[model samples]
Target: MALLNFSQPLISDETIAAMADTMRTGWIASGPRVLEFEQALSDTFGGRPTRTLTSATGAMEVALLACDIGLGDEVITSTQSFFSTMNMIVKVGARPVFVDCDLISRAIDLNQVEAAITSRTKAIVPTHFPGALGDMDALYALAQRHGLRVIEDAALVQGSEWKGRPIGSFGDIATFSFHPNKNMTTIEGGAVVVQDEATARRIEVLRFHGIERLEDGTRDVVVASGKYNMSDVSAAIGLAQLRQLPAFLAQRRQLADRYFEKFPQIEGALLPPRGVAGQSWNMFCVLLPFASLGMTRQAFRAALRERGIATGLSYEPSHLSTLGRSLGYREQQFPNAERIGEQTVTIPLHCGMTIEDVDRVCDAIGEVIGSKKH
Candidate 1:
């Protein structure tokens, strides 16, 4: 049996051809293609101002910078997310006030978010975990009540929506990832959608060395910054990927449905929330009964590997990392994030997977868990 990869990008011939055409243009740096890609992204987000960068990490950093969040300011966010989520807060010279995630959806708990707000709280950075969103209604309401900025970390939820409104379309600031494993790929790029053109201009300046083009063809450094612009080569590939995103999301949903139907109900296994509205289903992760079955996650993965199946650890608790600890976070501070992080595994589910692939993975998991329980 072929090894069932946990996540795989479905790059088409059109994407390769577009990349070739871009390289042949002799202007592979940020150029027309980048502008076109940005425009297309803006349209996708209900004509919101959009900008592309090298990575979502840069996108979040730029969003924070554009909002003028800096030293001594507090940004409330979840502890369940990827390291970059917290790292970017620290990168922007702001304090990241961590909150625990919900037990099932893995979204940041809004009540804790509200409780953690302080006078210094300048922003709320909420991540849509693996395409599942938190309560946007309450989150934005809280932000509005407190007069805090909202920078949505929508990296895994490119096509996700909230109550019929698109994620980036209605949010204050939303950042999306186009990494290889995401719902769509720009090869290696990310985009940010802001509320207005002024902030968009600020992001553009911040992304590329803070240079403001002067009228006389001279360049002026308005503020010191770094290069994070997406190349035309990446933009060209992104254009192609964007065209297929709707279909890609549909495929992911179908695969996820198969997982829901086929995965056996082991007593202590914790599955992700099903039938979520507006979920793009970027990944289908589950918390297996590793501890209950007397098996470590490592051992469980190895068991699947023996069956020509691959598994992935979606995340470990970011708050338990060295950086988080240094920030005064202890082990039990965020119980839900800690528990999910320790036991979660991302199974095979992507645009490249079929229903049969989902079934194979489910069968293998059932075997692994069943054998361990015996």
Candidate 2:
């Protein structure tokens, strides 16, 4: 039996062909294909100004630069997300003020976010947990009232919507990832959607090493920045992937449904939220009762591997990392995130997965944890 990998990207033949075409054109660097992909994404986000970048990390950093959020400014964000969310804030010389995630949804707690905000708070960076969104209405209202810029960490929620509005469509600034394991793939790329053309133009310069074009066709570097441009090769793949995103999301949702239905009713094993239809269903994560099962997460994963299955940890609590420690974060600072980080496992749920695949994973999990229950 083939190992059911935790996550996989669906790269169709057409996507490969598009990549080949871009390579043959010899304009594989950031060029027309990148422009096309950016335009397509802009249209997808309700005509917001969009720019493609090398990664979502770059997008977030650039967004911070565009918003002038650096030097003693505090950026409020979740402690439950990938380290890049906090790292970007620090990269721009800003302070990252973290709030613990909600136990159920894994989104940042809005009340804590409000409490974390102080006089130095310049922006709010909220990450939507895989396929699930926090209270956007409340989040934005709070940000608006505080005159804070909101940069959504939308890495895993490309097709997700909030109350019928697309995630990036009306947000202040939203960054998306096209990493291979995401709902869509550009092999490796990301995009930023902004409210206006000026921010978009600034990002263009920021992404391409801060080189502003002069009238005589010469480029001048007004600010120090690194190159974070997306090549046409990646963009070609992204354009093809974007075209199939809806179908991909539908498949993911179906797989998620199967996981929910087939998952065993083990006591203390917390299931993820049964997200709404608007959710993009990026990956299915479950928090297992490892201590009760008499196994560590490592041992449980080893058992899954022995059963020809693969499992992954979506994240480790950023606040407990070495970097987080250097910044004065300590153990138990964010209990929910620390708990979820230790116990959460990402199971297979991808466009390439079949309903039977979900059943196989569910069965393996049942065997591994269910039978081991105290």
Local error of candidate 1 at 72, Å?
1.0
- Per-residue C-alpha lDDT of model 2 across residues 1-374, encoded as one tens digit per residue: 78888888988999999999999997989999999999999888998899999999999999999999999999999999999999999999998998898887888899999999899999999998765789999999999999999999999898889998889999699999989888898987889999999999999999998999999999899899999999999999999999998899888888888888999887888877885658888878899878877888999899999998888897898888898888899988898999899889998888878999889888888887766754
Give me the overall lDDT of model 1: 0.89
Give the per-residue Cα lDDT of candidate 1 at 363.
88
Tell me the tens digit of each residue's lDDT in model 1 across 59-149.
9999999999999999999988889999999998999999998988888899999899999999998888754678888988989999999
lDDT of 2: 0.90
Which sections of candidate 2 miss by over 4 Å? none
Question: For model 1, which pairs clash?
Answer: none
